[model samples]
Target chain A: MNIDLFFIPLQIQDELSLQNKTVIVVDVLRASTTIATALKNGARAIIPVASIENAVKYASTLEPGSFLLCGERGGKIIDGFDLGNSPFEYTEEKVMGKTLIYASTNGSVAITKTKYAKHSLVAGFINISEVVKFVSENSDDILILCSGKLNRFCIEDTVCGGMIAFLLTKGKSRKRLNLSDSTVSAIKLYKFYSKNLLKMLRESEHGRFLIELGFEEDLKVASSIDSIPILPIFSDGVIKALK
Target chain B: MNIDLFFIPLQIQDELSLQNKTVIVVDVLRASTTIATALKNGARAIIPVASIENAVKYASTLEPGSFLLCGERGGKIIDGFDLGNSPFEYTEEKVMGKTLIYASTNGSVAITKTKYAKHSLVAGFINISEVVKFVSENSDDILILCSGKLNRFCIEDTVCGGMIAFLLTKGKSRKRLNLSDSTVSAIKLYKFYSKNLLKMLRESEHGRFLIELGFEEDLKVASSIDSIPILPIFSDGVIKALK
Candidate 1:
């Protein structure tokens, strides 16, 4: 297994070149969790937009009332959008059978960048096992791209990425794995922070910023492991729950 | 104290902005260790050039027998240079009272990028405490720049940067320091590998590469904590031992 981990998606020089590799885009603070929750709660499909302008533009094409315009700028709902980025707002009652136009500060940008990946899976602690199982069974070359907070490194995302890497390669012979330096550092971080993930998230820079915004409960929602057991795959610019 | 650590110097947006901040450039595999070695061995002053052309150009201006052209490419001595990037070659008798023009693949590039820094200190395990002390007594806003292997992350540099961070802020109240996520990650790595740094270096990707190239002994030179007991400060385009 050849595993490469990037602390931030900005490190990717040519996103389309990743078309041959299984790319796992992780955003633990909210995006991945919100996507999983929206899908698990019966959202029809998610159109992840890189910018607010794109989100609004994409929403315009959908029939009125069939889609919900959603996103956050600086952790608050964009003015005039139907919903914010918080997972709680993505509950079944609001999303069921509706196409969601989603834009986020970091996660959506990262997800959109992986449109050319052979298989791009959205992952967070909420659906760790499903993503891990999928990668282990289907991938020989794996790239775990952390959606850092707007081009800067985010501890929560890297830690989550590390956890996925650790679980996938744990107990395996070292000879079979070609891991990068960042991957090795990441796995070591996973070992250090895995004991109490909720605490880890609460202490993270982005997590603290979220808490300061009165979204502490969002941390709890994002930290639950395997609660939403589904792989939300990104393909051809749309995200949907993989059956 | 506010501390920010970057895995590679590429992260610096404006290298001139570092002119107000004390920058510690660490390349544990060789550059830093060799710089410290040359200074400790009584080289008049070391001029670290970014590229071979620059090194040769700078060397031509100095009087013959007063300066030596030194550097390495692929861990071997560059043709027509007096020395390679090995600490063992920089004995007191060889470098005494002579200015040296130095260049290396990664470290020298990073060192030159910090030309505008208030003070750029060369650091490695060989002279860690002195680097730490210089940072502790002199500056609060600190930047630890890891000279990663040619823009790609190298575990050894990050580990060395982490060790400096760990030693500087360990046991201090968290309220005192504003560290970035990468800083927190680096310190954790320092803690994880502190027990046996030599073994960690031996296993790192760059370390293994150095060993494969018959520089296994160089790792021993680089990994010796506080053995050199000197701080090589880069200032006015030249590096010299801090008095």
Candidate 2:
């Protein structure tokens, strides 16, 4: 199967042409893990917005009792947002049956960019095996798009993309991992770092950024492979858990 | 000293905002190498352009017969261009005392993006020591911008970036690396693959792309470290030898 890859920094979202492609939105740090955990814990739905303003406006339209404001900026929760972008904040009772209007500095911007995609699936190392299985079952052509930090390449996302490429290439050699230079390097990186996911995340730039912001525990949650099976797909501009 | 690293993929040219920063343009595959070699081989000046059309348009403004056109696309020479994007082709006899209006699929696009920088220098593995020395002498924040292939993170560029970071951060426990995740990973990849530079290049996706396009020997040219030492810096949108 033919697969395309996009490494997006948040600034170039307007230039992305994701139509007719199964766009996999990968934000390995926290968004994918948080979304998966929220859904697995029975969170009703997650609405991703590009900016905090949009999240606030979208929440105003929803029933106040059922919707909660959420998101982060500069790795910290917004001053008045109900939730910070941590997986731990998404417990079953706290999130269950409640719609979360989520926005974050980078992840939400990436999700919002792919809102027009034919099929957009959120991926992280945490649920990679499931992602590979789903993509293999629905294989036609794919775009492995990484949600880089503000229009720059982040090691975690590229490594995660590399992991997906590695699994797909290893599962069946016939698929011909016809990849770009970046893809080849990423696979090599995944091979080198996949042996220790936690260590890789802990030493990364964003990892340190999150750590400085006191979100070290989230890295552990995000790094756990194949822990969640739900696919967070974006359609009609809403990200809902897909079983 | 603070360093702000930028991973410049080809597609994000217009968005490059290098106001009042020392920008280093990196294209480890060939352009950076070619420019260094050309400058070292006694070429008077090299002009980088984003596209073949731009190269032609810029060359048109130069005195007739004063400049030669150079560049490549898909790793080969563009039709009617005077030179393809390869260092070996830029011998002393061909380039001496002449202006090269150069363009490539990736490298030149990245260089053009940094036109607004306070200072712009071309970088490659070949001149690592020289580049490092230049960076060390300057106390201003250093921007290691990787000219990713077609707006994607190519391994060679990242590895090169990592090498720069490693060089800067080695043996200094007091001074933190404070690098982006990509920077940290690039250094690790460089250390992982430093034993065999050509082998790493040959196996890399970009290397293979070059090989497939009949530019296999170009990889050898690119792999040779410290083979060229002359620095090419851009000022007033013009690149000239730094004597």
Instruction: Please give the fraction of native interface contacts (Cα pairs under 8 Å between A and B) kept by each candidate.
Output: 0.71, 0.65
DockQ-based CAPRI category assigned to the predicted complex of candidate 1: medium
Residue A167, candidate 1: alpha-carbon lDDT? 92
Alpha-carbon runs more than 4 Å astray in model 1:
A56-66, B56-66, B78-82
Clashes within 3 Å, all models in order: 0, 5
lDDT of 2 by residue, A1-243 (tens): 667666664434453466766777789888888888888889888999988789888988988789778888888889988888899988887888999999987788888787767788899987888788888887557778888887777778988998998887786665465666566667777888888989988987788889998899999989988888788888888888776
Candidate 2 overall Cα lDDT vs. reference?
A: 0.80
Off by over 4 Å in 2: A2-5, A9-17, B1-4, B9-20
Q: Scoring each candidate complex against the real one, what DockQ results? A: 0.63, 0.50
Using all chains and alpha carbons, the TM-scores for the candidates as numbered come to 0.92, 0.89
Model 1 TM-score on chain A: 0.98
Candidate with the greatest DockQ versus the true structure = 1
* Native A-B contacts reproduced, model 2: 0.65
